[model samples]
Target chain A: MTRVASMALATAGALLLQGCAGWQSALDPKGPAASELAWLIWFFTGLSALVWVLVMIALVVPLMMRSRAQAEPLAIDAGADGRKLRVVMTAVGLTALILVGLTLLSFFANRTLAAIGSDASLTIRVTGHQWWWEVRYEDATPSRILTTANEIHIPAGEPVRLLLTSTDVIHSFWIPSLSGKLDLIPGHMNVLDLKADKPGVYRGQCAEFCGAQHANMGTFIIAEPRAKFDAWWNDQLQPAAAPTADEAKAGEELFLKRPCVMCHRIGGTPAGGTVAPDLTHLASRQTLAAGTLTMSRGNLAAWIADPQGIKPGSHMPVVELSGDELNAVVAYLEGLK
Target chain B: MRAAVAMLLFPILVLAACQREERDTRPQSALGSGEQPTPVTTLEPGGQRASASDNKAASFEANAFHMSEGKRLFGWFNCSGCHANGGGGMGPALMDEKWIYGSSMESIHATIRDGRPNGMPRFGDKIPDDQIWELAAFVRSLGGNAPSSAAPQRNDDMMVHPSENRLPDAATLGKSP
Candidate 1:
């Protein structure tokens, strides 16, 4: 009873560690990416268990059949139980061959699944900025390639091909629960096709070390139903409207007057520079500064005051701006729906 | 028993032989005394005088050839992290006409060897003198300067000396950022 309890404890400990094995858990067939990988693990694990069980039985059966008195190495004998040994050998050999066959089948299955990519789906061009992702949905009508700052939304169950490129150095696109990462290289377009199996919000971050602020370069994907995506797409198609209120108008004039226009791009407006993240839907995002802080009035105010303090090594130069000007800019950006 | 031992040993021997063959075919660097193609080039193409390989003293090739080494090292050490490929980033662009410090070859060499205070770390001990010069040359080349014709001749110019810090700046470094 004690031995059994200890064995159970050991198994539980190993299982706990295995469960924490972030990317390689067999039980984590939670999405399309992990599910695909799980199939490979299942085949290999099954074969491994079978082989181990057979080997254990072969060793145990020999001991069980013999008496305790005869539990000793026998003198070297050429003539032994030839028939029984031949049967055992043949069984193990066939088991090994089956294991090999299963492995080959799994390998081919993996290759076949990986070969299917971006030919039939809508292509989204994702460019990595200093610490943000510039997502452009190329297939939207008006031929709109809307640059959403960090959070990306897509229609559920539809194949989406991401044409990954980096504006600066190398950065990797990784949405853990959805799919494996594809690197964004400069002067090179690497295409990765992915589809969310279900409608849910999945967290992702930059897997490559681009610079100092690489850690805060997080992004999330909100996979919604087709109807909702269409609605969002329609909203994105509209041109940038003129500021309605007096304060917003003041803010817009200030934004144009300041250095904000030098680095950022706001579509249908005069602020057309490509050095920084596109702020067309800046207020629409759930977070600011490339998902570093929540998009609140206070957070936005703090971000404008000192960007370096919030995210070290970000390219947005910190300039001296009054609290009123900051509020005005934030209000103007917030109205850019 | 002999056959069983042979079978066990056979796979190990085959693996060892394969490893040996791989090792033998590896490309060797020519800057060393042994016969190997130098990764660094000594020739500037436009009929330049060959300088002696006495690396301790300042040679005209140090500016031309070493700048090339610096360029190669820039790629090698992944300097594109901040000072991106001919573009500005968190760090200033090296290719543009903007130089934060003086743009002389010596100043550029100093900037690389001893990193600037505002984030760039000193690469003095990490990289060799020859390679630093090559990097400088590469940075100059990016700024549209013609390759110098007065570089050293022998492949021995490829020596990446760890302590030798006798690299001279280009006659004209581009303007600072």
Candidate 2:
């Protein structure tokens, strides 16, 4: 019986642990803040569970010993009652001490997390749209300030500050693997500081629902070595690559004539529209439509041809493009990287 | 999907954009100049419309509700991001009467449609005509109620004073004209 119960408990524990797996799980943290947070969560869970088990035992012990303990206490000896009260007082004192300790632990953990980003070298401003993120890297020179969408690149081991605000409604920016969520409210800028201990790709999402495509509004944080980060930033500052292939050139012309350029901007080109995401480096992003689909030629074609089919209530207009136009546009965008 | 973004902006834009020639013949006055505008219709460059050319600037530009909607659209389109609530940052300030283009209601709409040579993105295609007019009405209202950006002791971001500076025009500033 003991063996079966232990096996069952082990199986249950394993099943519970599965919830904290995968790319989006907070418990599987990759950054300093997130790792500390995960540790704090585990510490509290263990401590609370231990206390609960003890309380349950205290409740069960009286029932199990009722025949002997209760009957013998019927005589009601004054000295024995004093001893029982002393025991209860000691238990209460222990519980109070434990509670105080846990509180201090949380306080210190927060301090540790806060101290990680004081010397951050990079500053990125993330503005929340209804269903996308407009990311701009701040720079002293006006020409050097690079603007992109959906993807953020930070140097590993160096702190980065993200200034968050909303253009429409309230939204929360959260990267479960890096840090806790911070709200992006209208007319107010909130700052969140983060540092990745190593190079990796971390997925982020909008924790607060802004509108219809709330679930699809996602962003990626790519942490790389300092050298690679600098390279990427320099590359992004360049305009969209010129369409070299014949098919891509035709697609570019069609984009100019069609409604595509009206809402999307391709740097160094005549297509300068601001209401939608800047597609200057569209193909370089990991996902399209704010993580609605993986970045690929097929998905780009599908998104342009019929956006409503992929994400209901999305703001992307369904452009009327023939098969050849679709292929050419896809060819153009795919070569943008 | 286009309608979702343009729902609040349908009728107002066409009132201003479609009628081009009639506006040229009308008397030029500053926005809210209290001079009554001549009633007219318009001819569009493309298939868009000359049908609703019979509306007046007084109706579309002076409506209180449309101005309010335009104020909301200013932030919606991230105009604040570059223009910094119209005092000017990346783009020139709209809070002042100082417009490189004409500051009339129609001229402002034209600028929005055919973006300037600098960084102003063309919003004509994505935004419906009504919303554009609403935005124009709001932008035009800025300096009308606010102090100038050139004021010695100015608090100009909110546009709460009268007569900000408009940049010098070669024709009007004792130049070639």
DockQ top scorer: 2
Model 2 over residues A101-173: C-alpha lDDT tens digits?
9999999988988888798878999999878999999998899899999999999989999999987789999
Task: Write down the worst ten-residue block by lDDT for model 2 chain A.
Answer: A65-74
Q: Please, what are the lDDT tens digits per residue for candidate 1 over residues A17-94?
A: 687444423355445555676666677788788888988998899888856564557755455677768887998799
Candidate 2, residue B43: Cα displacement in angstroms equals: 17
Where is model 2 more than 4 Å wrong at Cα? A68-77, B1-177
TM-score of every model versus the real structure? 0.58, 0.67
iRMS (Å) per candidate = 18.3, 11.9
A106: Cα error in model 1, Å: 3.6
Give me the displacement of residue B24 in model 2, in angstroms.
Answer: 39
